[model samples]
Target chain A: MSQHYYEFFCPVKVVAGKAALEHIPYELSGLSASRPMVITDKGVRGAGLLDPVIEACEEGGQEIVTIFDDVPPDSSKEVVRQIASAYREAKCDSIIAIGGGSPIDTAKAVNILVSEGGDDIAAYAGAGVLKRPLRPFFVVPTTAGTGSEVTAVAVIADTEKSVKLPFTSSFLLPNAAIIDPRMTLTLPPHVTAMTAMDAMTHATEAFTCLAKNPLSDAHATAAVRKISTNLPRVMENPKDSDARLELAQASTMAGIAFSNSMVGMVHSLGHATGAICHLPHGLCMSLFLPYVLEYNLEAIREPLGELLLYMAGPDVYATTPTSRRAETCIAAIRKLRDQLWQYCELPRTLQETGKVSEDQLEAIAHSALDDGTIMFNPKETSIEDIRNVLRRAWG
Target chain B: MLAKRIKPMALQARRLYVETMFQVMGRALQAVSEVDRSVQEEARALPDGFLFEMTVMPNGPKLVVEHQGDGRFQYLTSEPPRPVDLSIQFKHIAHAFLVVSFQEKTSVAFANDRMLVDGDIDRAIRMTRILNRLEAFILPKLIAERAVKEYPQSLGLPEKVLSAARIYLKVATHFVETARAS
Candidate 1:
């Protein structure tokens, strides 16, 4: 056998259980935090998941000094600055990011500002800009997807320029991640399906992308098995805490896998669509997963076949050679998406989200072509190819 | 013909060693070196009329190397032999080779759970000894070359002092980790 090598590094302490939130204080205690800022969206606060975290912090002798719950779905750079200002004024020693991608991303940005003392979020938009470490931060994801709890990236939309800026630094990774299934139990069916699909996309893309290594592949495969097995079960019974924890753990695993290895065209396209059309990030991922896989099948067939075997088992591709199984994997993904669509009644096309049109195709293609994730796709995708994928994804 | 004198056992053992060795070497070169096109081209040029094939796996890539000793090595991807001269199973191909070579982990493939090597114990021992000596000489030069290209600031350091410090730190850290694990 040919020799191979891998480097594994994810330092996020994953606290996963029915009452995983209870472990958050213990996790944070290691970081020496006495006062923490609870950062979340108004939606999460409205859903009542934030109260338990606050109570747990109080019971653990950790003070919640402030609650910045103004984060929106597509978090803007301005929102991050505002939250950072609030954090400073509150004199909080640490941050408890308690929402989905937006609040977590905002918390990351806020930490950057609080530590680095930068006004313009654009200044540190690229990779490896932060030379110093940030404050102790913990993530409590209320969705079973996004995997933001473990990722080193924080994407913030620059509303003024109308583009999403990805801030990446290894130091931006959270100190700990609290994945309580109880937090995700109340998610609406549409959000649940879209977010779970996002997790699956992360695992699948991580498994199939150019930067994939053996370590990433193992994590991605395990995540795919967990998500594929648990997402549907949780969908059937939203209050199934066991299934919810499985999905949550899957999302966390996918997050760690993709964060180091990177993702591919699905995320590139989703970022562009989310930026221009103002759709939910996970919803955009769900709409484009199968389409991008089909488009990039020729070049990424081998890795994609590995994903198929891991997700659906070897029998799914028993009749095909490893080289030709990419199409089979894409077809399986389409079938799964079809089932999820039927289950959640989510939009199957970009047009269903109200932005798909012949006129908008050029902008969507241009945006996707400019996204950094597109570069890591195994195939060389031109603007026209991106346009084709967008047109096909458009209903 | 040269084939008439070749023992099947030796041939199989050498083929397995070369295959695994080249695969690990190629992955390490790719990880630390920025010259991807040149490195891939060089990897495609393994000596001894050898053929190489690689199969990407969930844990890592498996490689098969075939050689006729006619100044060319052919590479192909296929199943590895159950009993071979030396077998190494690592958590990932990149880490297995890089950590062993650059991080100075002596026989990490045998010691760590991330990698396992089997068969022809004497040959394996000889190969590991040779690799360790080669790593001792080559790793510093490789790190220096990469540092100049990757981080220009390293070029200004006083050669003796900087080299001494780096060696000391690496050995110290390696010793501590190895001790803790043991």
Candidate 2:
């Protein structure tokens, strides 16, 4: 139990393993939905991820009324509106999001519109605005990262305003998350590495950040252990179904953990860097995780040290002295990153990406301070401190 | 029967503290807008005529303020005629007291899920920064350090003392006027 008062919530039903995708139709029907609008991206579609999903639905005698697969890598308000229109035009009674973060977020946004009766998502922006349950929503995550499937938040870019609009509510959670290894089997090496690291970061932050409760710690530690043991094996053999399934389940557990406990400075800086440098979200998480742990070392040492057993297993954990466990945890994360870089050229630093300039570090720092996630960081950070971290991460 | 009628809302001591804190916080927003450069910068970043409100849920003390552009703010004596751009509602009076009495920093209170904000989060973050700046200026350094995430390092002791005096005087006058009005 936490000494401080805390609240934990994750109502999304998780359906994982080999038969997960096949069970989606049954889950949708349980919600009294036979007509589902499938939302995904071209990448997942092109990768033939939809074939099995379509086959499953058809075999179950549930029709996918329509599919809007043109979703951009970053879901936009306009795209959401368009999907809402198509969802209405097609008379979609439910939604099935079959991709990564974008499509799932877009589905949640579309569910808001169709269920709540609104086209302008900006009207519903902010926390606790959705006052009712959304339409039947199911997620089939094609990637192992971005626990958007179980999370209660969506970030849709408002292109006209040049700002990311965040919509948060427990209502945004999917009715069920279908985590089938078949869907993620086609994920490229780099994406697999980064997305797994994203899960790693989520679990790490959830365990150490403020708002952490006993329940969240359970999920976070389990996720960390799963990812720590399985990520390397999956990277070595991308076709390993068991490893892939473990990774996917770990991602969902991490999602549940972070959704309740919430993330901290890693996410704040990662979001800022993504906005400024256009780096992938997972890559930013990987780049910033170690540095932030080092920065919040004093405040979060006990929890960080406790995470060593989960992250590095008993051998390393038992060997490391109590005084050095926290630093050893960070070293273990750095070691994992080094291993990932070898597996796939996942950039270890901002400079290696050939995208972020030194001059942009100040802007990133400023932007990060404005981020809501910063409030959850164990250590209160100054712009100078953030800039120092960014500079160090710049390599 | 009378004993049973005494409800949680009738906890007079907590109510008085919450009301007094809200009153002082309202006045302090007005004073800091005039005195603190950082508050002004934050106000300018907000949308024009942005109304910010802080209240406790289930009918507790409420404090409302408006951004009058160019780093100026006005404390509304009554509930605003229009919906606020951002509103942070503490789940209970005790939670509000925890934050108001410097027992919990605003960021910590937020992280602890003691409060809920309705409206733009970015603007809410901006408002929190403004509140942090106000706390740094008005509260004692030792207390302010506990109430805010980071105490402004550049705020010298002399400047803090001088601003705290001016702000407290304004707060005192505001309360006096409220007393007379009531």
Candidate 3:
């Protein structure tokens, strides 16, 4: 219940829906660039998602001067430095990143070094260090889970030190975020479900966290409603392009929502568990989400009630009593977890994650308290509270 | 020596804010801990030799506070001070004020790139909680609402008014004594 003086910012131009990639040239043209460097991971290329970017370049009468497709899953400073060198050598004017969070982040880091002329990215580790806007950059996210396409910060792994270096600036935001369903159409059902759930977590946390504002609430609510309506359809039929588009839009909207408002303890816990246990981020999100919702149940009941209405739609929301609506939201997420688990073995309990041991719970809790997202949790969490949440999440 | 390279007029303005922040933070360390046990509890969670420093971008008038054993904190010098624990450096004067003036919370400042921390981020977070308690005691309801991540749900109106006034008196007394000694 802090003050009403929340500042809002989202500078990335979004092009979402069918054939959005085709519109990339127009967006780049406005930035006064035609020759762009295409950056992606080998996985996205193997998945055939790069075809659209190639097709768009061909149709737009522009050729990518060079392609750097070996971006690692956890983007490293060395990788970014190398990519910056290649971009400079090829005389590329702009950057086009096509993949999930890693490539988008790598591209952002490379853009920083390429534009700012720094050999070491660690120098730009903290926020506001970059003095000006980076080179014209765009992101084509192949996965719906990480909204790195629209986010203003990049967390690139420091392979040497085994830590993630965070680079943040309004300047780090991409000039555009292109969300084409065609790009994410080939994602497997498990990946689809997990990423969509990740978007849902972003929206939920944004709506309920201490930083929740009127504008962010609107976007988060819309994102939750869209994800609720479309996640099932996309799960039932993976090829449903319409459902895919809605999920993509939800992910992007949720990204904008959380990046501005920030997420809560769920993300803090998720980040710790994921980093420590080497679990996938979206998968961690889906597992810890219900437990977090339950933990913040009383503190965020009003927003939880509203989310119940959004997730369940009008008909069910009407019948649900005010006292029980928050529980209803938690139950619905539990149901989704059960379904996703049945489809693909997504662990519902922390104990179910074979990688995590009982002994590691204390370490996870301690690490979570350090995470930047912990500040936004509605309840000021103590180490004990974190441990308790982990204990409940454990079983 | 502080930012000697900055323009004189700009430096003067920045120093006003910096000096005021120093006075306020010093008062908060003493007054809030006296009134609120939560501040003490939060501070007690940190290790001894914990240091929190604030310096404006490109500059002088930097302030560093170190945690004395138990839950007490006293201001220290800007230099190594036994290998500092947590340091928040602002990129510019306006960026520093964004948090100092209670316009944004520390976490929001971190998220927005308004400030940077160079050591022990978890310990930094623990220190932030302690700072939040001080803010509740020092700032009025309207101003505290922006600086604190979450306003205390149960602190009654009368005590809030009483604590803020107490903090103001203590801050004034602190500055007067420092001026006399100087």
Candidate 4:
């Protein structure tokens, strides 16, 4: 119904495949940068992912001034400030973020501070605030999740205010996202399953949300089909480089799709859950996918019907009546979660996580209402409505 | 001292005309939607104390409509008398008039990055539904076809002429009152 007006933007040049890691320096050369700072987290380092990145940089003849690998799970403004200070001291001309969401997000904020020459990055909060392009930046995600590589939005926690500040603009997008399957080869099966489901949520919710347009719809549908085909294959063999590349490409496409159309209540509730429980974001995303689909079913049955056609091939799709498409989509999502749970020991409910407590339900429900993504959801999501969904998903 | 220069994207003459038109339509819509035997159930489903604002942004010449709880709305003065619960902000003057001047459909304008919503989503939805009701009354069949998701039931030619005349007369009276008060 909201098809009346929409605009899509994804300027990130994505390099995806087994050999993509070797091309990072060439791409950075295209951005005219020779000295780049490598930003990562301890988890990525402990997993021995940073060594290959360093070797590849050396092989590309690009100088690395410093490897600042202190990013926490949720990047804060203070951390970004510190990272920016390091970038300056090292005289790095560009940033190369290697890891999951946190390092990529920290690099985005650091680019803002370093380029804008502002000590108070908080002044750049909210949507459309960044007017100028940022320093040449790139990301190499270690997990097939969070598509932070291509999105034009960054969430940095304001440790002082105890709130998350969202900075959005075309400027926040990275110059390139290198998706080498080697980057995620070390990722555990559980992380692979959960993050793949997160990508599925992004693809499905982007398709069904109010901002859906022709361009984003194609990307979202393609992302869903890719994730559906490759998730189980990667789960079966975590070391398969080809399967890893497929899932990684799926995340990038899904990220670009959701970045353009934005997401709906699944993301809103997931953010609330992650904020309240300090749980892994992908776990929270996978847990809420089916429930949010059902909640939005009545309002967006047409889009959901279309998604059923994407997720389920024409064989099953043709047999199902048009009226049953929404149900089929919801069932398919639940089936996927069940498969992941049985195969990988992934938690299907919030209680199974053991990090989330029953007392946190009210706070999660209240916080979800404050999340901005709910605005794009096709259905009206009230606080009571979020509370009910949380209760049902709480197990 | 530097003189203040107006922003290039500031709301312009066309936007003012659009505001004036909405002021007229704000008063006319409730009565028109309430006309007997209309099945646009959502059009007349507005709650009491609801406030809708159309702001031409980043700075705005904002126009507001407040539901009076009697199946009617009144256009408040340039400065709203009360807090606006929902604000639909156009990116600039060009976008503001594209819908306000009937050159583009409201929904289409929204999809085209012509506008942004800054407040409650539910109230925005309700206001869009109400605006469609007014569009049915105000716009010609060709324009209304593009504007509304589903066309409201048609009024006969004889009734259409009479209703249009009556609605404009009431709108004229209200517009004059607004002008004098301002």
Please list the Cα RMSD from the true structure of every candidate, rounded to 1 decimal place.
17.0, 2.4, 6.3, 8.0
Per-residue lDDT over B24-76 for candidate 4, one digit per residue giving the tens place of the 0 to 100 score: 66667644644422313443455676777878887756767766765556666
Question: With candidate 3 superimposed using the best TM-score fit, by how many Å does residue A191's alpha carbon deviate from the native?
Answer: 1.2
Tell me the deviation in Å of residue A96 in model 2: 1.0
Off by over 4 Å in 1: A1-8, A118-123, A158-164, A314-324, A352-354, B1-182
- lDDT tens digits, residues A1-395, model 3? 64345668898889887778888878888889978999999999899888878988789987888999999888788999899999989999999999998898899999989889978999888756888888999999898878887788888888899877888788989989998989888899988988999999999999998778888889899999999999888888889999999999999999989987889999999989988888889988998998888888899998899898889889878999989999998998898888888877778888787878999999899889878789778877778889989999989
Q: After superposition, how far is residue A321 of candidate 1 from its true place, in Å?
A: 6.7
2 or 3, greater by TM-score: 2
Q: Over the full model, what C-alpha lDDT does candidate 1 score relative to the true structure? A: 0.70
Error of 1 at B139 (Å): 32
Model 2 ranges with Cα > 4 A deviation: A1-3, B1-10, B150-156, B177-182
Q: Model 1 chain A: which ten-residue window has the lowest total lDDT?
A: A1-10
On lDDT, the stronger of 3 and 4 is: 3
Over B75-127, each residue of candidate 1 has an lDDT whose tens digit, in order, gives 23335433223344454544444443344243322322344333322233333
lDDT comparing candidate 4 with the true structure = 0.80
Q: Where does the lowest 10-residue lDDT sum fall in candidate 4 chain A? A: A1-10
Report lDDT (Cα) of residue A183, candidate 1: 90
Can you write out model 4's per-residue Cα lDDT over A241-340, one digit (the tens) per residue?
Answer: 8988889999999998888888889888898898778878889889998888877778889989988877987887899999998899889888888889
Indicate which candidate wins on DockQ.
2
Write the residue-wise lDDT of candidate 3 on B1-182 in tens digits.
35565667775776688677865786667666566677777777777777777776677446777777667676542364476667777777776666787777776666555666776566777777777778876677788888876677677788888887887777677677777877
Candidate 3, residue A61: CA error in Å? 1.4
Better of 2 and 4 by DockQ: 2
Q: What is the TM-score of chain B alone in each candidate?
A: 0.34, 0.90, 0.82, 0.75
Output the worst ten-in-a-row residue range by lDDT, candidate 2 chain B: B2-11
TM-score of each: 0.66, 0.94, 0.83, 0.78
Which residue pairs clash in candidate 3? B2-B60, B3-B59, B3-B60
- lDDT digits (tens) for residues A25-141 of candidate 2: 889878899889999999999999999999988998878899999999888999999999999998889999999998899889989999999789889887888999989999999
